[model samples]
Target: MIHPQIPLILTALLFSAFFSGMEMAFMAASKLQLELQEKQNSLTGRIITHFSTRKARLTATLLIGNVFALVLFGIGMARSLYPILTAYLPASWQYPAVFIIIQTLVTAILALTVAEFIPRSLFMIRANTMLNVLAVPLLISYYILYPVVFLVVGAIRLVVVKLLKMEFSEEKPVFGLTDVDQFMKKSLYQHETEKVPEVDARIFHNALEFRTVKVRECMVPRTEIEAIEISEPINALRQAFVQTGHSKILVYQETIDNVVGYCHQLAMFQKPTDISSILTPIIAVPETMLASELFVKFVAEHRSIALVVDEFGGTSGLVTTEDLLEEIIGEINDEFDEESLLEQELQPGIYLFSARQEIDYLNDKYNLALPVGDYETLGGLILEMHGDIPNEGTIIQAPPFTITVLSMDENRINTVQLVRQAELTAED
Candidate 1:
């Protein structure tokens, strides 16, 4: 009752899978090409955006070869399997099984392994290099594949999308924002690309910081900032820089908030006898500047920092590229920075300690004062308590953090961390 076109029909179906899978693998190279040539346009840029461009020669080979392969299988199925299967397999059974099993299996295997898997693996292997080489061909793939796939899917989409009001793109591939975020933040992403821990940390931190960070979150308190008075003597100004070791010193009119200008370290020694020498213009930015905008200014100026000021023209605090970077890296320390943090994790959140760091910095970070006094340093507070260093295990109210001493080094308190009992880390 039926012509035996079984083999041909089966082959056609198998071929479709190969083409689809090829499209996916081709998609990978396309992505890489686009990323590389995002700035470099022309045929090169077009190619970079092209689906066939990433792994060009191979993709073109696949595109040409696989298309014919798809036709062979499709013809085989329509002419051969359609008749025989319609006759042999009961109509009820054919509809249930979809009457396309053999072809499905073949194409699925070829597409998964040969077209999709193999090509994607290769593209990733040479991702960076191919980005330059394959830009053009990928674009060709885009144009070639889109219409063909859309034609195949258009009638089906018309029924589902218009009559049924279902929404889906048969020709266009889709992904989510989370996918992009994961790729950017993934450890494997920049493994060989950027190996430095600090650099990696900075990248990760920046990704996280961009979401909702406000200026107030990073601004230094009005009190701790060391400023230069406009009329302050040169010796005092020089002394201030030496003691605080800050690069951009805020030069204020009268009060710390009433800032007028900034002194760059590079120009510090070059300050002439002229009164204007000490009065360099400040790199002032608003508290509302988006982090991304600030990042751009940083790149254009080739500088790593800026000053956050109020609308009234007063200095609020400083923001270094490093500080912004720290939003990702946790913290960046140089050879000069001492690791005065607690030596051990005494408990889940608590840390043991010696008291020697500035009380103001600690108060700023840990809020260790019950009523925060004028006292500026931790060592100063400990000394003032009994006019001497308290012995091991001295209990006192340091305001926010509970003090539990483990050891002391003569007059210097040493070996301590905090209990971080409350939401300390979040508040700071």
Candidate 2:
């Protein structure tokens, strides 16, 4: 018959292995694996997901159980080893320290190899199967020890959190806006490099970035806005409408700053041609308004276009529903819309781009290390470098890449060309 101490030691070893395996399995289980199992109506998946949702509590339960098992194992090892140590050592040297040291070394080796390492190794490779087999026992232990674990956890948290005033949250780490932007860009890169259908990839990529886009980034600048003065005659308004080929036009009283309203071409013909009679109340939104939010607001307000205003209540620009939608679906061209290339490689290394083109796009397409921070557009980047608006023919040297202002519109760079100085010199 086996000695009582031997049985106790063996039980302790099994207990240690069980808890270690459970902890490893729970932590290593992938979300995708859990999801697939849950879809297949697996009980283990449901249980694991439940524990995962309350990770802190599950962790506490595992720690408590593991500690209890190890304590029993330590006690049994000390008891069994005491006699063997006494037989080897002399009377003077046969002290508790000797037995304790030997027991500690042996116990640590046994705990690490037999209890922790082997179990953890097995659990990692066969996590789903191991977790499935051990689910009921783990769940039972979790519930049985929960009250004690909860009290211990609460007492520790009270001292660590309340008195220490440290932040402790149970929620899982979440992805921020920046993370989402990067993830979308990565996905887009994967699609492009992997040769996903161009149309599908473009649609997918545009849809992802649409939410983060701001109205000011895509709005038609005030300089380019076609507005009819309130005093303009009906015949003049009709002529202006025909020439502009715009269905609706902003109706301003004295200046664009005093934009009264907008009038539809259909309304203009139905009523008097005078801008005031056909004028409809227009909604004003800040330039900082997100494109997605603007889209929702447009639907709720039943309006097609809004005048983007500055902090000082002056008209900054105009944004249409089409402008917001185009952020996701690409440019919405119309009969009146001018067909122009936003970016073009003039030659081998030299390229010309519209000022409105985003700096990120230029960096990605040209494989240049353009620094990105507060500035979004190439014009903004140039302006930031100059500390003022750059004029026509302003050759701004940004090291590896040299930017030349090809065209300008008053306060901003309209068109700019970038060329690698080294590459251009080599060619010359």
Q: Which prediction has the highest TM-score against the true structure?
A: 2
Q: Write the per-residue lDDT of candidate 2 for residues 235-326, one digit (tens) a residue.
A: 87888789999988888988999999987788865869466787899999999888889889989988788999988999989988887777
Best by lDDT: 2
Span of ten consecutive residues with least summed lDDT in model 1: 170-179
Off by over 4 Å in 1: 1-4, 24-180, 188-221, 264-277, 299-305, 310-314, 325-330, 334-344, 347-349, 352-428
> What lDDT tens digits, residue by residue, belong to model 1 across residues 114-134?
544665566566654554554
In order, the Cα lDDT scores of the candidates are 0.56, 0.80
What's the CA error at residue 131 for candidate 1, in Å? Answer: 15
Q: List the residue pairs that clash in candidate 2.
A: none
